[model samples]
Target: MDNLRLNLGCGGTHHPDWVNIDFAPRQPGVLGYDLGREIPFPDDTFATVYHSHLLEHLPKRAALPFLRECFRVLRPGGVLRLAVPDLEGIARAYLTAVDAVARGEADADARHAWMVVEMVDQLARHVSGGEMLAYWRQKPLPAQDFVLARLGAEARLAIASAGSAPLPPDPAAASALEIGTFRRSGECHLWMYDRFSLLRLLQEAGFVAAEPVAASFSAIPDFGRFGLDVEPDGNTRKPDSLFMEARKPDAPAVSGPRVVQVCMQHTGGAGSAAARLQQGLSAIGVPSFLYVSSSAGHIPGVAVIPAASGQTLLREDDGRTLTHSQWPAFVQANRATLARHTHRPPGLELFSESETAARLSDIPAMELAQIINLHWIGGTADICRDTAFLKGRPIVWTLHDMHPFTGGCHYAGSCRAFEQHCGNCPQLGSTDANDLSRAQWVRKMTAYRELDITLVCPSRWLAGEARKSRLFRKKPVHVIPNGVPTDVFRPLQRAPIRNHLGIGPDDFVMLFGADALTNRRKGFAELRAALERLRADNAVSGILLLTFGSNTGPDPASLPCRSLNLGRLSTPEELALAYNAADCLLAPSLEDNLPNVVLEAMACGLPVAGFATGGVPDMVEDGRPGRLAPTGDIEALARCIAALRDLSPQDRALSRLHCRETVLTRFSLPAQARAYADLYRQLLEARR
Candidate 1:
């Protein structure tokens, strides 16, 4: 076997033993030529190439070339170990937690984790004065870190002090369940992936032997500690994480052009949309370069470029700064950029070379893929313009909120100002909001003019807003609503499911789906106030408030309302059952593009009640499938719930039928997948 063990794109975290290659000299591994050019290794030089969370950031055009190069460089029978976040698994994890919470069987740790996350976010916001960008970028202040450390340490101590669960006599069966249970806690996950898409990308990239392997790690200390069976000498660590291993059988290594995927925003809400999208694409068919900022952690299919030593500044084409050692990589990257440019518009041809290279140095340019750009947060419009990553691609931007258009506010708060170049900002209480809005509008217009991108609005309301915006007025805009698979979110008819969960059949369950609690936008506080009012009312007797997504909230169990944090779901089926069990899904979001939970709940045949703002009007027709309250009307919300409780059986049945049909007809997972696939194919054809 060849002795070469390659750590592809290893950064500060690279193992001391491996031969590492990275663009940043500051990275713990070896500094090498830019990854954009052909790799320096000889044909069949290495026996193994290990890449973890490194591929999703590359431009789509360079993906094929990078894979071809990987194959050429690998010896026959050589193994390439690749790790990316598993999309399907994450989706399933999302569903399972929601299901568990609905059934009222939430574990303690799961609940605590949610609380910790909320607390941390709250502290972060308090310190940063509520600026989304500043809040996200702000590292924990000293006091905040001290508090976080104390909290984390306390939690760790408690967990360590808690005795493990006693294993069942049949260890095998119980082990499976325990493992399954641990796997279902996906609150920590924000993205999803799977083997089908991953394998396709590997195969397309020239790998002949590509297969997925089961891998996991135990968060629990030991099976023996939990009174479970242990092999005499077997490793005790639980293994649940997943990865792909691919190999090339033939081809001589060639130093070809290189490509890099740069991830701009890594932490917090700033680029969460981009992160989630990249996570989705990791498993999808494409092999590209990933270059992420130092602050960001591991993402499957991405390569974290280390910062080079101050000594090695290499001035490249378009005046972009890079390390001397990264020159070859830059050349390769430039070539890959050119290959992608072949599919772009004519006027864009003028500055393709400089435009492509300029991005790697800055944050905005890193995660640019050929067909899509996961533009993050509100302020990225400038980065979008300067980097020109949108030049040839169909940029599918998922606005976490409307901040980009509402003069730098995440929620427009009933402001029509955004419709016509946003002036007289309602949120800012200033007329100059229009001036700021027009500047952004001009920036967006400039971007729209250059790229063959599509403005993807998760909600119909957002899509309508886009139409009103001067920037997207002439662009191709589509409202592809988010979906949760009905299979995972179906009604649970099993008696034990209810009985084991300890939820009373007669209990009036008032439910809410959660995200960031500090984000007044999602309306958790309003939900809290409304629930309190219902408690004060005699009509609210036997009411149970259920919230998921955000773990931190008023104690559901203490209020005699069961709380469960299923964390993030790994499958859709798990979510369906939760939806089915709910009496009502609360979506009192002050402002939303579109809430997926509403659609998921309706699909599961449950009635929804929430504020009738954003794209929500597009989903609920007021008591047809679900009820919509006036935006921020706590009393109206309480009244609506009381009314829903009093509805006749026949009316409830009709409502359920309507809800199911609406989702099936318009928002089924299959329908969305097919639509996306069709769009992909169309883009391909247009490129040709």
Candidate 2:
């Protein structure tokens, strides 16, 4: 926390407690800066920004933009207090002086004379110090106390200096250039402001709750400590100033950098991870909005993109969208690309090259987002098709898989084609170098070339793979593991929960979960083979498998052991229960990014027995937290599972402690949010 307060054009009101800034820079420790230039600070860096008697120095045309600059630097809900010479107060004082003069009060003419000079001299003055300086030097000053009361400490000091300093450079002898230079030297007020007009000005600059306050009144804590407007003796420093404060609103702007995350849905691994990241950001004082394909329930700051009901015309110049009546034809037309792959192999990973109908601009929050976060936006090709909507916004795209870099495939598997140009893709079953995969790779890479996207991978394996690809080889890459809610996923009373789930206290239960068990990438086939081997070995007994997720895949009952299918554990509580009831999580994914199941289970104090693929090595190594074997090796996988089952009571508990500690220190959502907050600031600090 470098001082979270900013003082613009501090002049003589410099404070050690504030980040004092002045155009003149005569004061020590004050940053010499001009209001017209962009402030060399990240967005929402300060909690409060203050400037005294500085606004009137700016030309009327530049005033609103200058206020907007104040808004940009102040955090949301932060205070922006400014002091300017009040025109209304001057006029009322002038009228009161007139009434006093009419009543023939002593020094009434003196009071009126000072008022006229105050109101007109600042605007019409040409020479430095002007007529007001001459009045200060008057031998028997007209209304001397009234002038002190009106002008405060600055005038008293100016008056004291007038007697000691010798005047030079007669105005009559000055050249045209000398006079021009004097006018721009900030000796005169370029504009005036009243409370009423200032309120409107603040509102136009995107600030709310604008109102006038006393010199001693402010939302800033210990504002008087700075002694900018009031001295310790309780006398005003600049009594003619009117103080006002306005709040920087919580809009698309950042107090913590408003984040807009784009995800396809809010379920499954990618969607759930995206939603959790949003919650993480919110928990860390960053306001985040989620743009999903479709939202189910009402969640604050979560918005849905309109579902595509119409088809896009294939013809470039056609400019026609299909109607509901054309659903049959639309479906047929969409199948045209995949129709060529009629001989495509089955039992493999899912391949999608389809371009989504909804564009990134379709999300209404796009125009307002200060920082755009892209996550698992598969099928939403329009997000990258023409990234003109994302212009001027710092973008962070989280790599859920290889989808962001590869051609039409989430995982390139053994194909190194993405390292060059994706074509003749094994996943897409393409033979031609100029196939659909290459065309899509070209399309996506061309769009990416125009964007300054920073890629974030949850797994080091994914990041390394992303670097190998031509699409992201030049992009800045970061490894940020998917965060788990430690509070929700912490270890629970195991024996009681195990009894409730009909598992014996002595049973060796292993948990398994995924969107689908039949998905080849999940390595369910290998897990099943390994489980059969474990059942045959008398060394491992009391085998009980607790599985959750869609029932569409192969039945868990076919595991050659007792099994329970907790079909679709939709809530964190359900997932936590599954983690609690198990001795360890069985993750058999042959190819994947950092799986959310592994992170969640580990957070719940459950070790993992899985293949050493993707980011698994990052989490576990030879029972450090869990046991891992070479990927896709059934015998090695079975050995890993057996190693977990044979652990002594004390060893098992120690392993659980390791799992919990690993998640608490590395994978907690708060830590994830803080990392992202810092990264966002870094991006904004070096904004393109």
Candidate number with greatest TM-score: 2
For all predicted structures, in order, the TM-scores are: 0.51, 0.61
Residues forming the 10-long window of minimal summed lDDT in candidate 2: 313-322
> Which portions of model 1 show Cα errors greater than 4 Å?
1-370, 375-382, 420-449, 493-501, 516-519, 524-537, 555-581, 630-636, 647-661, 683-688
lDDT string, candidate 1, 1-688, tens digits = 2255666665443544455766444653364445544453434556667665445434446556666667755667677776654556544554654566677773633533343333333222222112222222333322333223323332333233333423213323445555443332221222324788778878887787788864332221221232111223443121223467777765544222122223344433333333433443333423333343322223444433333333233434432233332334444654564454243222111111112222333321233234443433221123454535445554455554565444444566656666666555444334454444445455555555776656667678887777776656776777766544555555567345445557678766666765555666777777777767777775667666665565565565444234555454433565665565567788888877666678768877888888898988888888688777899899988777777777787987788788888877877655654454455556666777
lDDT of each: 0.53, 0.79
Deviation (Å) of 56 in candidate 2: 48
Report model 1's TM-score to 2 decimal places. 0.51
| Candidate 2 per-residue C-alpha lDDT over 1-688 given as tens digits, one digit per residue, 9 for 90 to 100 | 5337888888777877777766656656665434443343445668889998888877798799788878876877889999999999999999999999999999999999999999998887778777787787778887999999999988888888886656534678888888876766777788999999999999999999999999988888889888888899988788998899999887554377767787866667887898889889988788677766544443444544432223221211222221112223434554676667866666665566636666666432245467889897654436565578765568899989887787788877777888899888776567888988888899888888888799889999999999888989998999988898888999999888988888998999988887777678888889888988977886446888888886653564576777887788767888898899999899899888989889888888899999999988887756689999899899999998898998999999999999999999989899888988899889988964
